[model samples]
Every structure is written in C-alpha cells, then in structure tokens.
Target: MLSQKAKYALRALMMLAEAAPEELVLVQEIAERQNVPKKFLELILLELKRHGFVFSQRGRGGGYCLARPADTITFGQVIRAMDGPLAPLPCASVTGYRRCADCADERTCTIRKVMRRVRDAMADILDKTTLADVRGGRVDEDLLATVA
Candidate 1:
C-alpha cells in the first residue's frame, strides 16, 4: 500500500514536473496547489532533495525544482525513495532482499515465489513509467486495460 507521505510526495513532484524548467516553486505554493500540508511537505521535499530528485534554493525567490528532467525520474525511484522497496515482503525484494526469519527454505517457499512475481510485475510497470509519462497521461493504455 502507498503511504500518505508517498502520495503527497508524488503529487508534489507532479506539480514540479509541470513547472517551467528554471522555475522555482515555493513550498507554500506547492502545498496549496497539491493539497498537501505545508509542514509535512517540507519534510518530504527535504527527503526528495537528499535523494537528488529535487533541488532547493534558499532565501529570497527561494523554492524547489526537479533536479533532473521529469522524464528521467521514474515512479519506482520516487516510491522507493519514500517507501523503500516495491516488494510485498523483504524476502521477495530484489533491491533489499532478506530471508524471512521463519522460512526454512526460501527457494521452496510458495509465498515468496508468488510475491517475487508480484514484485517483478510492479517493478516492470513502475520503473518504466516516468513522472512525465504520468503528468502527460502517456501511460500505456493497453497495460492499464489489461490490469483492469
């Protein structure tokens, strides 16, 4: 499940993605436009800046902007930055893999196998879908149709 923080972060990023390349959007403006709480958005923006997703300017005319092109920023990257791995379980994570403490044999674990497939399917879509794709409504319709 996507956390509220992650949802807010994505909304904020989408707002940034819509801005002019050199435009610096104030936190207050972003909060108002995206309907995110200003205090929480400050923390979220700081995290995103640390992850190199955004850059901040201090003082007068200060604000935030995408650190890279929106098309270069994948939803998977943002989600992982805010929510860790896309995997349903630690043992199923390719990026943060850890054996389940109670599992005697991971290779033979039915749950892990199913979750690995789930993780792969999620990564396949999220990693390929960029902020620009989403903001522009360019997501693969056939894929969405299949899912629906």
Candidate 2:
C-alpha cells in the first residue's frame, strides 16, 4: 500500500514538474494545492532534497524545484526513496533482500517466487513510468488498468 506521505510527495513532485523550469514553488503553495499538510510537506520536501530529487533555495523569492528533468525521474525512484524497497517481503527483495527466519529453504519458497514476480511487475511499471509521463496528462484507461 502506498503511504499518504508518498502520495503527497508524488503529487508535490508532479506539481513542480508542471511548473516552469527552475521556477520556485513555495511549500505552502504545494500544501494548499495538493491538500497536503504544510508541516508534513516540509519534511517530505527535505527528504526529497536529500535524495537529489529536488533542490531548495532559501530566503526571498526562493523555494523548491526539481534537481533534474522530470523525464529522468521515475515513479520508482520517488517511491523507493520515500517508501523504501518495493518488495512485499524482505526475502523477495532485490535491493533490500533479507532471508525470512522461518523459511528454511528460500531457493524453493513458493511464496518468495510469487512475491518476487509481484515486485518485478511493480518495478517494471514504476521504473518505466516517469514524472514526465504523469505531467503529460496521459492517464488513459489502459494505464490505469495496468497499475490498478
């Protein structure tokens, strides 16, 4: 399940992507526009900044903007950055793999196999779908069905 924080982060990033390049958008504005709490958004943006997904400018007429182009930043990167690994189980994770203590033989674990497939499918979609794709207003029924 996607966390509200992650959803807010994605919404905020989408807003920034739609803005003019290098345009500074205040956190308050994003909070108001996205209906995300101001304080929580502040923390989310700070985390994104640390991850190189966004950059902030302080003082007068300054705020936050994307650190790189939207097309280069995928949903996978943002989600993984904010939500940790995408795998449903640690044993099924490629990036954050950890053996389940109860599982005696992971090599033949049916549960792990299914979860790994789920993780891969998710990664395939999210990694290929960029902030650019979202910004383009291309939310077709097919896309929605696939993700859903």
Candidate 3:
C-alpha cells in the first residue's frame, strides 16, 4: 500500500516538474492545486528538500522547486526517499535489507525466488518511470486522488 506521505510527495514533485523553468512555487499553491493538506505537504516537501530532491527558498517569495530536471529524477528515487524500499519484505530488499530468522534456507527457498523476482519487477517498473513521465501525463495523476 502506498502511504499518504509518499503519495503527497509524488504529487507535489509532479507539480514542481510542471512548473519548471519557472520560479519556485509556494507550499500553499502546491497544497491547493494537488488537493493535499497544507501542513502535511509542507513537511513532506521539506523532507524532499533535505534529501536533495528539491531546494527551498525563503523570503516574501519563498517556495520550493526541483533541484534538477524532471527526467533525471526517477520514480524509484523519490519512492525510496519517501518510503524506504519498494519490496514487501525487508529480507528481499537490496537496500535497507535484513535477513529473515526463520527462513528454511535462503539459498533454496522457492518463496525467496518469487519475492526476488517480484522485487526486481517492481524496481524495474518504478525506476523507468520518471518525474518527466509524471508531469508529461504519461503516468496517471489521478493515482494520488484515488486514495480512499
């Protein structure tokens, strides 16, 4: 399941991408346009800024913007920055991994093989999807709005 936090971050980044080559956009504008809560979106944007996904400006014209071109930033990078890993099980993850204690034998477990394939499939998909795709309408913007 995608966390609300991650969804907000992706939407906000997409907004930033759309407005690129323009100046920064205020938090309130991102919140209002994306339909995300102002306060929560502010925190998520700050998190992204801290991770170099974005840069912030403070003053009467204070706002946020992407640090680089949208096409250069992959969805996998944003997802991992916002939510750790894409894998369902930590043991199957490459980054931030933890070996499972009760595994019959990691070398021979069929489930492990299946999970590895699942993880790689997920990674391949998300990695290929970039912020450029999100802003260019190649990816569905309604994904964030569809959360129940």
TM-score to native of every candidate shown: 0.94, 0.94, 0.89
Q: What is the lDDT of residue 130 in candidate 3?
A: 86
- Clashing residue pairs for model 1: none
As a whole number from 0 to 100, the lDDT of residue 3 in candidate 2 is 88
In order, candidate lDDTs are 0.92, 0.92, 0.84
Over the stretch 51-85, how does candidate 2's per-residue lDDT look in tens digits?
99999999999999999999999999999999999
Q: Indicate the worst ten consecutive residues by lDDT in candidate 1.
A: 134-143
Candidate 2 lowest-lDDT run of ten:
136-145
Residue-level lDDT tens digits of model 3 in 11-130:
999889998554799999999989999999989998998888888989998799899888888888988999998887877888877878898788887777788888887788788778
Better of 2 and 3 by TM-score: 2
